[model samples]
Target: MLKAPDHQVAGHQARDGSLGPLVDGSGHFYKPLQNLDRGSKELAFYTSFNSMNGIPPRIRRFFPSFHGSETFQASDGSGLLPHLVLEDLVFGRKNPSIMDVKIGSRTWYPGVSDDYIQKCFTKDMKTTSMSLGFRLSGLQVYGSEESGYWKPSKKAVQSFTVEDVRLALRKFVSSDVGWASDKDTLPDCSLATRIYGGPSGVLAQLIELKEWFEDQTIFHFNSCSVLVLYEKESALRGKTHGAAVKLVDFAHVLDGNGIIDHNFLGGLCSLIKFISGIVAEANKALHGLESSADGLELH
Candidate 1:
């Protein structure tokens, strides 16, 4: 099953599957203001959905060993705590290229993809955003960053490769399909037959999951406070694509009070506005804001 990592909230309360808050997400005061301490972690399931490879909850049953955790401390002694963490979760596991046995479309077999991203702590670093990710199914293909990240930088500790575990995970998750080596019979299923909802549905689920993805990595660190981010890939009719769902990150407060006012959507809109202004001022490309029917914040 997909086991979630342990975590600290707002750099204070600590939470795990067993230990939980006595109240809802919003409460108040050490008086049980009632919370899952700053240490409480988010669910890091490969696929939080009901299916994987024709099997129900494929991501969970397949990658059983996938694990991770986080801890936080207020570095400035400002009553807010910073967080620290370590984990081995799959982020970019698809290949940049693929060939489908079916048609003219290029396909990826959860293609070779795995790597680490780092965030550095600086005096001016006020925002800490994060997100879970949504990936295309039937064909696992991930693209690359065309350019470097804009501002500050944090060096990742090591390199990662998706091929290291993709085969194993596929074996583990796809019960009906079996492993590529098995050469098993074609099960009474179609790739779409395993579809819990539809392509759009699966895409939406992936989009939402990105939040916890960062919670285990990006959000887990020593800082002013905790900031959770999430970006969901959208359902497209053509080639595969990935979208950024996560946007705003809350600094330190030991209780996650900063984001009390903004939900994930609100935070994202704010971020889009900020980026739009910057690009406009710098005369940077607005990507496809003008031509595309989808209205981006840069308008």
Candidate 2:
């Protein structure tokens, strides 16, 4: 049996008075669901990723570790729902600033082939939005709420915008000399150096991850949420600190045969191109700042 913290409610209550998914005191995130097929797919994804020979360690570092699942019956004997448990990514972090942004879709463009675009739209409209630009759909800062359950923080939500993404992309593009110069390589780099902490190590890691995903060829991340986490104090101090980017929500993952899926590739390429543009714009702004700072020093 799952036990919630004494001070915190286990799951969210719906308008119908039924319980939703809950997190236990042990830091296990339980996602309650009625769809068994979706649950099974997610379980398989976690299982495959968690296996020793499955996903690469560098790429796997960004994923939340999955535990297992159990069927929980309502106390009132109303019905049962499968509770999928996984390690809480935001747990134990001090005032962790978290943003759950749906990836893809926002950066899409109309210039892409109609057939490809239509295929992507048919597959998933949300994922196709990445070609448009980054859009802030939901934001949450853990620990701000007194109840311990995840709640949206207004201040934190306002802090990040499509502009921030642009800036981060600039930092990534400017600092990623290797990937930027290599015309043979795809336009992809790490956001860690720009927004989070340290140098450009994570960019290389991200490239490796992208390559790994490309190599798979059989599966594609249909729709996923990019979870960005950072310490509030670190962000407020304007200092480099620990931060993480995790990909979650695999309900829309698609599988295919050996043939390459152009629609999938198109979506991925669009997202990469969008990030590159954002980063380029950000780099220009950073150069301006540096020039101003240099002028002040010269005086």
Candidate 3:
């Protein structure tokens, strides 16, 4: 029997000899009937991911494996509700750190009219911006005992700005010289390494993924969580070694024709430029550090 993870939003594991795979169906955001549409969309998205053969193995590894969805009648005789079944991320790990953070700003669009932009800065900024990209919302770190659940570390819940993301990209790129040596080498490395490759490589993969989504005409992901998993026993004491990133949440995903949204494409390009700029800046910082060391030796 699969124990439910503390961060689960939609469904829970079934009890012994349960009729179906899912039990205790809780609708999205604590609303049983209201969120059926979102639940359906999320289920469909995972279904597609599971069946699609075109997705690269490296990219596919980042996503949680999706099981089939189940329908359960409401206890009050309301109607049938859908529940998505997924693999528990922390099941059987030694020490696992799970961070659930949303990405993107729903209201922060590039090149939008000032009127629209002004509207975003209002009191409902978070509510309005929730659909932009994945944002950090909830976090959990599991311990080794029966009471495995624990509060998230500060670093797990820490929020990052666009600049911070760019810096992270820069750092990853600068550090992984071997991975960045050949463009083809990207797919050979882990998902995190490829997604966080040198600015150009990372941007290339983003474009590739976006174009693939466009071809599939899958509605773009808005406000998905960037899930990072790290193990304590890995290299660097789990600080920088063996970390993986996967994107989740498809409640706002839309269906579309085989056309890419210009605004979305532009936003991606802008991010690429930011990462590139930071890469240059990081290089400068390293050069300065080296020069300082040499000067110290001379003195």
lDDT to native, each model: 0.23, 0.49, 0.45
Model 2 lDDT tens row, 1-299: 45432222112333244555555656787766536475677777776666657556767787888887877764324678676778767666665645554555522234446875677565344322443323343544332234232333434333544544443343232223333334454323333325432233223333444565567765556546556566544544555535666777776565646645344444445444554344443444556555433212211
**Residue 149 shift from truth in candidate 1, angstroms:** 11
| Best of the candidates, TM-score | 2
Better of 1 and 3 by TM-score: 3
RMSD of 3: 11.4
Alpha-carbon runs more than 4 Å astray in model 1: 1-92, 95-122, 125-238, 244-253, 256-270, 274-299
Q: How many backbone clashes does candidate 2 have?
A: 19
lDDT of 1: 0.23
By TM-score: ranked, best first: 2, 3, 1
Candidate 2 regions off by >4 Å? Answer: 1-19, 52-54, 74-78, 106-130, 133-136, 141-206, 236-240, 259-299
lDDT of 3 by residue, 41-138 (tens): 67778887799877777567657777676555533344676556665554454455555544445523444467856775451253312333333444
- lDDT, residue 231, candidate 2: 57
Task: For model 2, state the Cα shift of residue 74 in Å.
Answer: 5.7
Give the range where candidate 2 is weakest over 10 consecutive residues by summed lDDT.
5-14
Among the numbered candidates, top lDDT falls to 2
